[model samples]
Target chain A: MTGVATLIRQPWLWAWVGALVVWLATAVFTGGKGSGEVLSAAMTFGAFFVIVALGQMFVITLGPGNVDLSIPACMTLAGTVAMKSMDGASAMIPVGLLLALVIGAGVGTLNYSLIRLLRIPPIIATLSSSFIFQSAAIWWNRGLRVKPPEALADFTTAKIAGVPVIALFVVVLAILGHVLLTRTIYGRGVVAIGQNMRAAHLAGVKVERIRAATYIMCATLAGLCGYLLAAFSGGAALNMGEEYLLSSIAVVVIGGTSVAGGFANVPGLWGASLFLFLLVTMLNTFGAGAGVRLVLTGLIIIGVIVAASGGKART
Target chain B: MSGRLSPRLLRSLLPPLSLAALLIAIFWLQPRTMSYFGLNLLLNLAIPIALATIAQMFILCVNELDLSIGGFVSLVACITATWLHDTPLLGIAALAGLIAAYAALGALIHLRNLPSIVVTLGMSFVWLGLAVLVLPTPGGNAPEYIRTLMTLKPAYIPFPIIASVVIALVVHVGLMRSAHGTVLRGAGGNPRSLECAGWSLLKIKMGMFALAGFFGVLSGMALVGLTTSADANIALRYTLLSIAGVILGGGEFVGGRVSPIGAVIGAITLALAGSFLSFLRLNPDWQIGAQGAILIIVLALRVLIGRAEARK
Candidate 1:
């Protein structure tokens, strides 16, 4: 628990180092400027996961076993609903965006009500809401693919200073998330509530409101991520949000955020997201198929959980 | 005496009673469903789901969650359609080993104090990977005998209904009315006390997980039997469906409280509810929403009733 040891114990550092190692290996393999493009591509794809993971990290920080299973559903809803509301018009982007966030907030409110009012477990409550939102997305689909407005599409693909604007947004969001969790009262309240809800409640923290906010934050970010993903892809597919569900959770876990809750690892999540995407690229570099890659992802998650064990929740 | 209508009593009765009411309502709306054959066809899918829910209930009884059930069932279906149909001994041995692996998972969860959710989530992928490797696609035939058994029809009763009844009865007796099951539940309710009383929480918890794996296998085989075919991705939805069934059946997250009969009843209710939605001019696509809406309403009612009782 010494300062140096604590620094060494930071798992996100290792994730980044692993990512660097992969990049170096790719450099060694390709032997040229290809690695840079690969790196940027990884970051660009990693941006989506990073955005989703930031929200997941907040919910994870809310307490042990707390997760927003409805994230993908929320994202799906936002993307499809936004498209429907926008009616394919480029000028209606802002309105569509607002509607998407509002839908996210609505799902968040449902989840909060289920957990708070009915005392349902966060996992189950969010999971139930995931079903609701998933169906809502399906109903909205109605034989239509969500075509994001032209401006939104341009914005998603637009580059500034040779860097993807979305990547910068992810970085800024990560910084804001880190600051919110570590440098702000509300953020501290979240950590406290996750650590020990009753204790935090007794300590005069607005435990309920903080928990509600984190879930809302998680869903809202998921909404934005969905919107961006739709715009980036130029249309929404039914399964577009499927990949985010486990990876976001995986990123938080890999980032060394304790699943037992009360711990926030926003910076670690950013690194972990980058690391995961890099790992995918590394696998692809080796000609690994999707099946093999999926297997490895599962194995790596299990390995990380086993390796990080400090006898959490044994009591 | 409040007519002895304690909220605890009503809460315990509500899930299955709601299911009964649902059945009656469905029948009232579509009277054709009241017949045994009609009910059988409607609830054919409920058999495996109920088994999985029963499996999930065992795990939840120990205050742990298994996100791997869906994957496990799909893997089982793959095995049933492929290896079990082709090579009985090897497939049977593999299944027993899988059950043992589940017990090992419980031991690991206890020994390492790992969160069951993450472990099971990770295990789910492994299971899915193995499943994809086995089937590689969605085409395999269930053994003829298995299909025959699944499709068995009695003159007066349906196969699924009878099977569900037995499942509910056996598990109810085993879990709710038996001493060993009480000890197992105690591991969740008061592990410290159970340990102090010289019972090994590790043993009970592992036993619970083993039972889950056992039921999970049964569900997988049942699903394959009902479908008469198997695919790599089949049964993936069972994970959430089973969890929903358990919760809808009066199960709690941390408490050791879970009802076996109610889980089966809940499963049937969910299946019927989905069918009812599609039957009532609702789009098949919107059945999921209908399920969610029903679940939330039931859970909210349970909460309100609990709060009222507290006030009393």
Candidate 2:
């Protein structure tokens, strides 16, 4: 019972409770689909958010005001690369994934240089890279709608033991992220640096190298999200990745992570992703237009950030 | 020899020098852009951008950012197209209300100790929603007076060039040259001292945000005036453009350092770059990448200069 209460007290617990309330509200209002079915459907999309938010959480946990603004562009570019490289060949899946990772690494390296070497602000550096990445995606696609590989699509769409394969895959990834954030030296180093950069540096932490690793990890995960979402969406499009940029940050904040950095809630991130996925889907079902839904999203982001940033500042 | 030239002088000279170099390149490659008409045509977009950049510079001077500037401008455009044309009094009242709301937002932000970016981002959605409510679609005409004002072309020089010069001078004089401007900047650079000096930081920030709103309205109105029509999404790109302009203009994120003249130069150079790309027949898709490259180069140069100063 104490364990249960403690779990409820966790920062991410509200997101889960809120998600459930929204799910119930949707079921009550729509009266069209069963709650279980809608939930599972929501999870299918939530998987993508989970993947992206995991990456965002790592970046956000890197410290105060450290944000990865290039997630959307990276996701879109990764999807484009995967779609272009695969060209409907299941045999080329590995190659496409490799290409996406390589490109993500290059972007990460550039971000590192811009922030560390050139001393450009993090927000500006990443935002500028977003423009560059989107341009690359546009040039690659050139308004062409290439079909995703048949075999990859089939695999992403498949079910396993009455559950979505994508959901299950994302769960595995979440577990991996949890382990990485808690049970590794790299993770500890990241947290220490975020908590107090000067202190960490004085204590012999490789602050620069760790910061570089955090960015690389973020871009690589975003790349992975792009490739996977491509398989789910049938094909990659130009604006597909746009939603993930802010939404990913929203998800991280909702997950109970301190906005000032040094801590992250891996499970909470997954929960928040699920919450946002369900919220948007439910809103769509109610025939609330895009503007209304966007307004609500903005409000939620403000509310969550205000709530987090208000109390989470380290003394 | 280097001691003869001050660091501040070099800093101020660099942006305009770069702009001159770019202009010379454009003149060499596409001589057609040198004429009054050609230059006016190419720089037609610079005025609104300069206004928006100045608005952003105001916020940056306080170590805050207003991500909603684009949305606020869009809302103003929608109003200018429909309400401003139909009922001028109501339109002016609405714009005034927006400025007051911006001041209130600043107070709320300061009171709550919240990050300005998220606050403004959320408000942006609210602005876009209101814009959609007002103008549901893309088609609305600006008032005749606005169109005429935007189209004023002198025979000797381009209207945009003259407009930009006036704007830079007016803003520079108001902020940098005025007494109250120091108090506003000091609110960012040294808040405790300013407070000790008996100024209300709240009032100063509110004034700053209100000024941002006022300029945002001008930018939106300028945009509609130039295009003669308005849409909610029309000026959304100005958000990023304005930020880039501020950065290119020799402003840092932390120090409350800014130059109105540099921002105008940055906006003009960016507009020219866009035109130059089109003139070169490069892929339209390449423009974003090229813009990013330019931003990176300029920022990288700034970094190099800082390092050189440190060495000196």
Candidate 3:
């Protein structure tokens, strides 16, 4: 009971509660008619962001000044390659997906190699890679758009029982992510490493491998999100993945993952994602443009970080 | 002392030397491109980015990032372009006002001792929104005089490039020689130590942020001249690119070490790299790969060299 009480008082738990309230309010305010469509869009967007956020959470939790700026770029490259190859063939959907996964893995490996081999700070290396990836996407498209197959697009656009299929996909991904973080040995090692790298290393955690894997996982998830985005949008654009960069970081941070790494609150992230979605929906409902959205997102992220830091200091 | 050069000096010199080498390579490959006219254009291109890099260097030296320069530039450019379309002096005034506004905002965040990155990020959004509200479709244009002044060359040198050189020199001297510079360095190097010494960390941080804001304005103003118009997303790449340049120049995140000359050189190197890519006619995507590769290489070199020095 005491443990439960302590957990309840955790910052992440509180954030989750806040998120719930925001979500409920959003649902209530947007009631009837296109409310369902708006909610589905929000869910799909939130889920996609969640995948990227989770990967970031893994890096942040370990806290070795770890950050991956290349995630979006990796996603962009993956989606571009996948869609470019698929070219609207229903049969090629699986192939495209597989290719995206492979590209993700390749990017992950490349990022890992740069970090481990070159010993560049993760942030700089990742940022540079991101630029490279964006350039690659631009180069691949050559100022043209790459549309995914109709079947894939149909899947992306499909709604079952008034819920977006992509939302379901996100939920499943989130559950899998939660399980991987909590139940697996690899997951435990990740947490252990995040808590204290030296201690984890001494305990045979294969710190480098784990770190590399985390990058890989992050890139892979981002890649998957990109595929879904491409399918939903019916094509891939150069800037498609760029917007998610900060939001992913924001979600993870708001979800109660410390910038320096340690414990991550999956539930908190879920709530935060929902909250963010609602917040954006509300802003859009108010008829704000992309510029407004960008500004709000940036402000909310800063606010959340400051609030969290203050809360921690108070505790 | 006669026989040995200091490692600090050597490290400080490396980026500039590399930058020179890169420029020479460009010159060798395309003499026409590196000609007086070409050099002038290149220099003009470097000003806004160089100023933005200096701003980013200030934040980074304190181990923080500023992802809001894009928004800052946009807002400043938008306001300058919109409100001062007919009057060049008003454009300059509006530019100054925007800088002051951003500086005040930056100072507020620093006083709160909050992470500069997060604060700047949010402020960027606010500014961007304001920019859109002011000019939604990039309709406004700069005064003809401002545009001509920006584009016109003096003798052999372009005005923008000359402006960049002047600003760089001023900043270099200010950062290296001033008492405030010392305090700023101390705060960045070890805030706790400075605080223990009874220095106001917040004050130092706020001052540094103000300096960053000033540079942001300079960059934005230069950009307005170059483009002759303001788009909300014009300076988006500068946010990260400036940081990259600062890091590549071998500046420490904490303020004790900075090389304005190196940063300019670093900017030049980047510009040269882009030019080289264009010259090669490689898929522009290769440029991205190259930047990433360079970052990885520079970081690796830094770590390896640092570790070697530590061992010694």
lDDT of 1 by residue, A79-177 (tens): 888888887898899998898889888888888888998898898789888988899899888868867888888877777776788888889988888
- Model 2 scores a C-alpha lDDT of 0.83
lDDT tens digits, residue span A125-226, model 3? 788777777778877877668777888888877889978788787788778888998898888888899889899999999888889899998888888888
DockQ of each: 0.61, 0.51, 0.51
Q: Give a tens-digit lDDT track for model 1, residues B107-204.
A: 98998888888889888888888888888878788978888888899889889889999999999999889998888888879889999999988898
Best by TM-score: 1
Q: Candidate 2 or 3, higher lDDT?
A: 2
Q: What is candidate 3's lDDT per residue for B29-74, written digit by digit as tens?
A: 7788666787886566777788888888777766677888877877
**If chain B of candidate 3 is superposed on the true chain B, what is its TM-score?**
0.88
lDDT of each: 0.86, 0.83, 0.75
Model 1, residue A201: C-alpha shift (Å): 1.7
DockQ of 1: 0.61
TM-score of each candidate structure, all chains considered together? 0.96, 0.95, 0.91
Taking the tens digit of each residue's C-alpha lDDT, what string does model 2 give over B1-312? 878665656666778877897788888889988898888888888999999999999898888887788888998999999999999999999999999999998887877777686678778877887888788889899999999989998879889989999999998998888998877888878777888899998899899999988899999899999999999888877888888888888876766788889999988877777776776788999888877877888777777777777777
